[model samples]
Structures are given as structure tokens and as C-alpha cells.
Target: MKPAGQTHTLAVVGASTLLGKEILEVLKERAFPVARIFTAGGAETAPDLPVLDLGDSYQDDVLVEEPEDSEPDYVFLADRLRPAPEGTNLGLLHSAERLAEAEHSKVIDLGGFMLPKAGGAVRIPSLEREGRAPERLDSPATSYYVAPHPAVVVIARLLLGLSERFAVESAVGEVFGSASEIGPRAIAELQKQTLNLLSFQKIPQAVFGAQMAFNLLPRLGRGRTQPGEPAPLERRIRDELRDYMGGHVPLPALRFVQAPVFHSLAVSLYVRTREPAPLAALGEALAAPGVRLRRISEGPPSPVEVTGSSDILVDALTADPAHPEGFWIWAVADNLRLAAVNAVEIAESLKSGGP
Candidate 1:
């Protein structure tokens, strides 16, 4: 096992993406023991990190060939879209098997392609319920580590806290998303469309397929959920939630939405507890390490408030008038930052012990 201060090199696939950039930022912000940085999928080169082109002719290799001394100790797959667009990281992470075969490097995927042969279960470092054992990285059962979906991170942290107090029966809510969830191109297109709309110019229908600027969508970009399959984003949350919570509670009625913001998620959730609890008792449950309850004086929580912050900001909480056991909770999280932080947290979790 690696010592805590022993520096490790990280190869960030899709380094040009929003989540990719955020991962780099979080790594530095937390002062992780990063010996060096390597980036993929960008035209302009970053100052310190060397670039690796994942071209079409790029050999399908897991141990990314680099200077022997600078070989990545771990890889962070942050591109949200799979089969990365042409000229992007040479489509790295398209197959998890190649990564698993790497003799030296460990792979931790944020959110992208499905892993090889069932992949590993989703992990939310913050709400690792019931003192569960950390998912072993070298276990044959785990092809790679998946960072828990950010929206689910928010829901899990908050709802589970309440469950510890009230035994939450069910939760129903819509998670509002931002362009950042779709990566850099989506953000750029949204910005372009917004400016064009204000200038009376023709809006670009690319990226999101429809005008996403100042608009909301049930789902965004390409890909569709097949029959009996949950929508891509929705499935991740549902599956991960179950994996973490087990059969202790029923899955929430949740839907993923694409909102017109650049970053952060505004989740509207209504939760029903097993027994009636006063508003004060339920409100107390919102106070957890990664969760911060909003102050009534601070106005409603929005993306602007959480744009660069680490914590998942939640506020606008109110108990249902008739059913005192049911409460409304609104949450906003910097999606990229939350996911990036969790990725690093998962890495830290590994340091405690790993094969």
C-alpha cells in the first residue's frame, strides 16, 4: 500500500472537459500527493502536464505508454460521454477491460462508459452507510471504481441523514441540471445560443439538439434509454442508491432534468418519513459534514452560490402543511466540483488500504 504522503501520478482522460478540469483543480486544492499530471483531449497544451493524443490509430492499451518514471499511478475518467468524440483522448476509456488489464495503474471512472462485465458498484465516499467496508480496488468483482452520481450524492447525504433520524419512507423529486453535466461543448453551445438570442441572431441547434439556452429539458444531448432501461443519468442514481442503501428503503421517485445554467444542480425533493416528526427534528438532520443548510436570511440557494464551493448547498426546506411527516427540500450542488471532490475522496479512501 502507498503511504499517505507518497506522491502518485494521475492521468486524467478527457482533461479538456469541465469535470476533467475540475478534477485537476480539486487535486491541487486538497494538496493531494500528486507527483505529476498528465492530460488528454485538448488542442492547447497546459503548462506543467504533457499531452497524450488518443488518435484513431492509437493502440488500444491500458498502461498508457509514457516515460517509465512518469507512468500514471491512477487514472481518472471524467468525460461524461462515452466513445469520446473524435480527436478526444483517442477515445480512451471506451473499454474498461483494457484498463483493468493494466499491470500497474488503478482506474477510477467518474461518469462515462459502462465498465467491462458489470463494472463495479457506485461509491459515494461521504455517505458510505452503516460503516461498510471500502470497495477493494484489486477485487476481481470490481473492474473499476465509479464515482457516485453527483445528484445522488446530494440526495443520499441529505435523505440518508433524515433516514437515520426519521426512517425516510420515500422521496420524490426532480433534479435540475446545468450545461456542465454535458461537458464543455454543451456549455459553449449554451453560451453561444444565449448571446445569439440576445443579439437576434440564429440560435445554434447543435450539442443539445434543441435550444438549451434559457430552457429546461427532460433529457439532453444524444443517447436514449432502451425499453426496461432507466434513462442513462437516471439509472446511475437509482442503481447507485440501491447499492449503497440496500433494501432498507424504497427508491425515490426521481427524474434527471437539464436546466439552462452553466454549473451546479438544483434538486427539488419531497421526502416522507416513517413517523411524524416536528419540523425542528427533521431540520436537524440536514446538518452533516458535506451538507450545509441554507439560512433563511441568505435567500434561496442557487447555482451562483455554489459555483466554486465544495459543499452541497441545500435550503428552501419546508414541511408539508397537511402531512407533517413529509417535507420539501431544495438542494444545489456544483456538479463538476462535487464529482471531482468525490473522485479524490475515493482515491483517499483507497490509501487507507488497497491490494
Candidate 2:
């Protein structure tokens, strides 16, 4: 191990995407110790850099790994997470896999490249107190650490808190997604579609493959799978939830819908408990780290309200009218901010040896 106070070099692949921008902002906000920062993206799409260009720097292996020395302390894969059309935007995934195989730097995956069985540890620092965040973050065998989907973090933390205070029987979540979850392309498409519709012109459907403006979709029109098959986003949430929850609580039944919004995520969840859950006691239990509880008098939390917020906002917590043992909660979180904060926290944990 190197000296404790020695700052290290870092690289962020796909550093031009929305998530990449968020990660860089968070790193600067949190004042992460970095000797140098390098960015990489698609050759044609990447912005021009002064000297540390990806073409010369990344390919030289100096940014990825040193011959007999350790240089880059971390490599973050912050690519567009929403599954793109097959054979599109896969260069970052290739870089992540190569870095993981090299085991030179601690690779943190903000992208969904590392799956449940990929041997990468799924980390949520907010759950560290609950013994849910992985303990051995710097394990040699596990070079990749997955910063889970923001929805997974929000749902898992809420369910974990409830399970700690009551016997949770089952839970159902309706998660509303926004264009920012895909990338800048989806956001541009949505904006263009909205303008075209208002002006009575042809709308673009390349990114979303549907009329994303003033519309709600159960699945994207392009690259759609067979009936009953969960979309890519839903499948990612389900797989990561299971991996992180570790069977400690009932896995929530999830449904993802694409909403005509630009950022953040809104979730409507109904949970059934083994015993009658008192509203006051339930609120006390749901009060966990990285979660903010809003009063009913404050109305419900909205995606706009939670933008740029690191905490998941929980509101409209009420008991089910017919079933005393059931409750409903509406949650909103800045999808990029939440995931970015968690990824930074993971790096913090590694530095401090906290988890």
C-alpha cells in the first residue's frame, strides 16, 4: 500500500455523458483527493482536450496501469446506463472489463456493465450502518464495484428500514423514469420531439423510439423484447436489488414506466407488513441515513423538488384504507445525483477504510 496522504491519479471513461458530468461535479463538491483526473469518451463524440487526450494517454497503458508501479488509484465507468441499441456505445464497457481484468486500479462502475454475477461488489454507503454495504471494498479478487441504480438505492434503503422495524411480507413499486436516465441523446430527442409536436412538425424517435414528448410508455419502441420480458432498466433494478438485499427482505415487485420528464425518478410503493403498522412508528423506522421524510401537510414530493438533492425524499406516507397492515409511500430522488453521490461515497469508503 502507498502512503496514506499521497493523492492518486484517476480516470473517468465516458466522461462526456450526463452521468459523467454528475460524477465529476460530485467529486469536486466532495473534494476527493486526486493528484490528476483524466477523461475518455467515444473518439468522434468526445470533447477536445488540451494534452491528456484519450487517444494518446489511455491507449499508452499509463492511465490504465503502470508496468511495475501503481498510478491511477481509481477508474470510473460512468457511461450511459440505459441499454443502448446493441453494438452502440460499448467502448466504455470494454475499457471497464479490461481494467477489471488488469486489477490495477479500483474500478467503480456507474454504468450497468457490472452485473449481479460479475463478481463486482454492489455498494451503497448509506446502508453501511445496516451491515449491507460490502465490507471488503478493496478485495483483490473484486476489482470492480458497482454503484447501483438510483432506484435500487432508494427502494432498497426504504425496504431495509421498514424490515428492521416490522415484518415486511411484500412490496410493490411503480418507478417512473425520465430521459436523463438514458443520456444526453435521449434528452435531446425528448426536447426535439416536444418542440416538433407543438409546431406540428415531424418528431424524432431515434433515441426513445417512441413519442417521448407528452407521452408515457411501458417500454421503448426500439430494441424492444418479447412480451412479458422486463425492459433493460427493470431487469437491472431487479438484479441489483437481489444482489444488495441478500434475501434479508422480500424483493419488491417492480414496474418501470417512462415518463415525459427530463430528470430525477419518482416511485410509488405499497408495502404489506406482517402486523399492523402505525403511521407514526412507520415514519420513525423509515427515518434512515440519506432519506428525507416530508410531512403530509407539505404535499407530496415531486421530481422537480428533489432535483440536485443527494437524499431520497419520501412523502405521502399513509396507511392503506382497507388493510391496516399495508402502507403506501411516494419517493423522489435525483437519479444522477443519488448515483453520483453513492459512487463518490464508495471512493470515500475505500480511502477511509470505513467499510
Candidate 3:
């Protein structure tokens, strides 16, 4: 299926971090048929891609994807990987399960350090397709494709499209996070602590060990919560919203702060409902189909107006005046342009599932 306007041959592998240059500017703002891009890393000098050839061990570019003179049908793991690494992919992604033995290699982990693996399968092709249960890059399954965490793809596709008409009985949120999501060294220490506290100077927290400028750090450098493990970014966003909302939706109650602004992402949802749904039926279930909802006279969608939007720009739409079924959902997502458009839309659904 990798045919729409061009052909394919991609690879970005930690390409000199900063979300590997925002996954090459979201794969050239989603034109991704990737006719040849290959920018490998590690000691990284590798960045001249016009059909490759910076070769000569691009500073040991981690075995340049099994080099048969440039091989990368799809590889985008944009930097920051370290959960377990021993025998190389030097610029990381052997992050675990040896990336399921790279069968014809298809690893799209936009580096959530091996995307929520409490036993795999957390895909979200805008919420699965083909007879169900997300498995079709020609069925066999698991050639590695992580990408699901842009706040669990904006809370699992806005609570699985509002649980197909108000079935979600609970959800409480507050994920703010922004300093360009810690990359250019926590955005150069949040612009050097907002210019050393607006020129008074001295606030140089060794890259967010604290004082994340203007601070909302509920736990940006957390130093507590040790008994009964769950508070490390709300237990990894409730185990990635139940591994991509599979239990048919339920667990929410989240709260991952640390925002001083640099890129997008400002969710605040509070939904609750099992029956009687209102407030224009939860604003038409948060404007369902691949979502876009931003009215209420357009006032509350920030993160600098969802920077380079790939939509999730919802605004403060309130409703629980006394819980007639309760509601409220404000959002803003561009977190690395929705994790580089969900890793080039899951490598264009595995290159359009074509054999």
C-alpha cells in the first residue's frame, strides 16, 4: 500500500535527536511515502539525505539497518532510548524483545522507549480497522511499530470516540507537559530558566532537576512516591490508557504536569457518563470522526494555538453545572506533531498493508 504519490525507503533512527528533528519535520509534514530519507545516528554526522551515502561507518551508525547499501523500509525511533540496551543498535532500539526480531524490519517507535509493552499490541490506525483487533501489515504481526504515545494518541482517540456514544463511565485528566517535551536539552533548560528568572539570573537547574520555569511541575523531578508504585507519570499514563484502550475503555484519572510551554499538548478532560449524556451530547462526542472540535467562540485552545496542528485542538467546553451527566474537555496536541503524525500514520498503515 505504500503507493499514493511516490514510493518508499525511509529511516530516521535517532537522527541527531530533538525527537530526531521532529521526525524529519513529521516526514515532510506527512507526505511520507518516503522515497529515500535515511539519516542514521549515534555519533551522528549523518544528515545529508538525498538518496543517502554519508557512509564510511557514519560514525558507526549502528549498523545502518542491515546495510545492503541502505536498507530501511521503515525505521523512525527518534532518540532517547535506554530502558535496557546491551548489544547494539547503538543509537538505540533493541530497547527490548530485541524489537521482536526485526522480521523484514518495521520499527516505528517514536521513542516512548519501547511503546508500552505490558505484552504488546497498542496500535491505533485512528482506532483500528479491518475485521478488528489491529493486525494487518499482512497479518503475521509484530515487526515492531510502537508510536502510540502522544498522550496515548490524545487519550486513546478521545476515549475511543467517546465510547461509541457515552459509554465511558469515567475519566479525569490533566496532562500538561511542554518544554518542547525535553529534547534540545529540555529546550536549553527551558530557555535557561526563562532567562534566569527574567534577568535576575541564577536559576540554572541542571536541565529540569527542578524549576521548570514558571513551574507547574507536579513532579518534574519527583522525589517521593516509593511505596506501591504508581505515580511515575501516573503509572505511565495508566499503562498507556490500557494499552491503547482495549478493555473497551475505563481507567482515566491522570495528571502529568510540567508545563512552561515550547510545543503543544494541554489536555484537561473530565468526562463521566454511563447513560443520559448531554451538553450537546458531549459536544457531539468531542466531535467524533478523527476529531477537530474547537468552538465556544474559539477561545480556549492553547499551546500556542496547537502549534503545527494535526488536530486535537479542542477548547474549554464546559458542562457539569451539577453533573447532568458531567463533562468538560479541553485539549491541545502537537506533541511532536502528534508524535510525528503517529509515526507517519503507522508507516502509512504498514505501507498500506500491501504485499
Candidate 4:
């Protein structure tokens, strides 16, 4: 928890995109102790509000004329910058090279890439970076360390204290990523494809390989490289979980599929635990702090129900009597919101003490 009475100043660069906009919404919804908020964008298409013009250089802090507004204290950069600007404390919402040359107050990078030796920013990778030893922050560590995927964070939190009870077996995730996930280029392509029907019959294959409309892609990330190759995001999660749980827990076999829906990520876990954990007991465990267990007596949970929701919904749970050890569970959450919140939590934790 944040220290009492201490409000934090925040700035959100690229506030126009899906992830960036979602971050702002989460901040507002959670009632985060924000003293001031600054929004910046590259193009004028974003909301008509006060913003800071970077103009390709980090030196100048020229404020755009606004109706009567105040200055911001901290800034969250959702835009892509090779090296962050100088002077101000930054939250690296996108990946970039080392900006050690700049004297930033603190930097929280959303990209999972390894940081330079100088140390200043905190790298919060996806659920994949969980078990690995985090880079040390020599200077004032950034305010947040976060992942952009909410389902990952919620699942991680759920498993945090319950690692001893069950063992995750084969796991599958269905992602309904927002338009922002592919950025403006993909959205523009999608819109263009939607507008012209007769001659412009082009398949949307830029951000996602296949046409995403009314389709499902079983493979995501760089696809299967080779037999011995790493299992992209899913593999990373399993390895990291194993590490975080101190190897006492079994790593899950994961399969991720991309769905056509927008905004949320839903996951189904098929676990083989040592003992049979009743549905009531499992529900009680999921109801623990930070989770919103949905009580569903019927069909499977969908992305539409989880979109925009900050809480991770655990809907269905059942036992596989054949393999008495088998347990099935369902989970859903807003990827952007959950990821940003988890990153912020990490940032706060590092700010107070080393993680």
C-alpha cells in the first residue's frame, strides 16, 4: 500500500492508444492517489486536451495551451522512444534501448528486455519474467514494474499463495486483445478493410498473420521455432512460475490461442493436483484478496463479460473423477488493466524497498 497522504504525480504519454487509455481508466477506477495527470500524444487525433509536445526531443517541456490546467509531476511514456528523454522521471510503457545517458529520476519499463548495467529502470516483463531475478535499481527505482497482460497477473496472484495445494497441468489461454494491441497501423488496416468491400478485398495480415475477423489463430508470438526452441510466452510463464514457486510446484504445459474478440484474455487451466480440492474450497481460495471469483453454474465464460473489468473472474471449477487429481478452472480479465496495475504494484514495491 502507498504511504498515507502522499499523492503521486503521473503523466501518460500516447494516451490515445488502447493500452495507454486503459491505464488511465484503471488509475481513475482504482482511485489511485494521483495528485496530477498529464496526457501526451504524437498526433492531434487524440482527445483535445492539454498535452506536452516532445517534438522528437526530450529537452524541451513545452506545454500545449489548455483551458486552465496545472503541470504534472510524473510521466508515463506509452509511446515508442529509442532512448527516453532527460531530467524527468519516466515510466517506459514501450521497449527502448538504454537511456542511461539521461539523468531520469526513475524509470519503469514495460518491455521485458534486460537493462544496461548502470541501473535506473525496472523491467517488468510479461508473466514470463516472474521467477527470474529482477535487475537492481541503483538510483531511485521506477514507481512501477508491470506486465501488459491482465490474465497473466491475475493468474499469478491466484497462484501466489496456493502453490502448495495443486499442480497445474496443461493450460490454454484465449486472448481477445484490444485494437490497441496492434497499434494504429493495424487498426487503420482493419478499418480500411471494413470500409471498401468490392475491390479492396485484402486480408488483414500485418499485425496478425491471418485475418482476425471471425477467426481464431491457434499460434501466437514467433510460432514454434524448432523442437528444442523455447515456448515463447507460455513457456516463459511456466519457467518463471517454477522459479517463483521455488521449484516445489510443477510447471504447466501451456497452449495459447488468439481469438477475434477485443479487450480481454480468458484462460482455462486443467490441473492435476495431489489431492481433490472441492469446488467450494477452490471457490473460497479464489475469493481471496485481489480476485473476483465469478459463480457460474452453466456455460463457459466469454471475453465480452470480462472486458473493461479490473478484477480477474474465476467462473467455473469442477473435478475430473476419472483422474481424481484432475481439476478444471476458468479465468478472465482485462489484459491491459491487469498488466498496468501489476507493473504499478511492482514499481511501488521497489520504490519503498528492494524486491
Please report the candidate that would top TM-score against the real structure: 2
Over 160-194, each residue of candidate 4 has an lDDT whose tens digit, in order, gives 43453444443333334444344555445444444
Residue pairs in candidate 3 whose N, alpha carbon or C atoms collide under 3 angstroms: none
For model 3, how does the per-residue alpha-carbon lDDT over 238-289 read when each residue is reduced to its tens digit?
A: 7766765657778787878888776677888888887657666667765645
lDDT of each: 0.69, 0.76, 0.65, 0.50
Instruction: Give the per-residue lDDT of model 2 (tens digit) for 1-355.
Output: 2324767777676666667767777876666776667665522233442121112222222223212224367777786323223454323334434455554577788767655435777888768856744334354566678899999999988888888879999999999998878866777778788889999999989888889899999888976776779998899899888888877889999999999988899999999999997888988888876788999898788987888778889995898899989999999999988998889888888878766
Off by over 4 Å in 4: 1-14, 31-79, 83-104, 113-148, 164-180, 184-200, 220-232, 235-248, 347-355
Minimal lDDT window, size 10, model 1: 50-59
Candidate 1 local lDDT, 192-298, one digit each (tens): 88889999999987778888887888875465767555677887778777766666556788788888887788889999888877877777877877678876778
Model 1 spans > 4 angstroms off: 1-5, 42-71, 80-95, 112-114, 129-143, 221-223, 226-230
Can you give the TM-score per candidate against the true fold? 0.81, 0.84, 0.35, 0.66
* Model 2 misplacement above 4 A: 1-4, 42-71, 80-97, 130-140
For model 4, what is the error of residue 229's alpha carbon versus the real structure, in angstroms, after optimal superposition?
3.6
Candidate 1 clashing pairs, residues 3+ apart or interchain: 54-90
Summed over model 2, clashes come to: 0
* CA shift of 179, model 2, Å: 0.5
The TM-score obtained by model 1 is 0.81
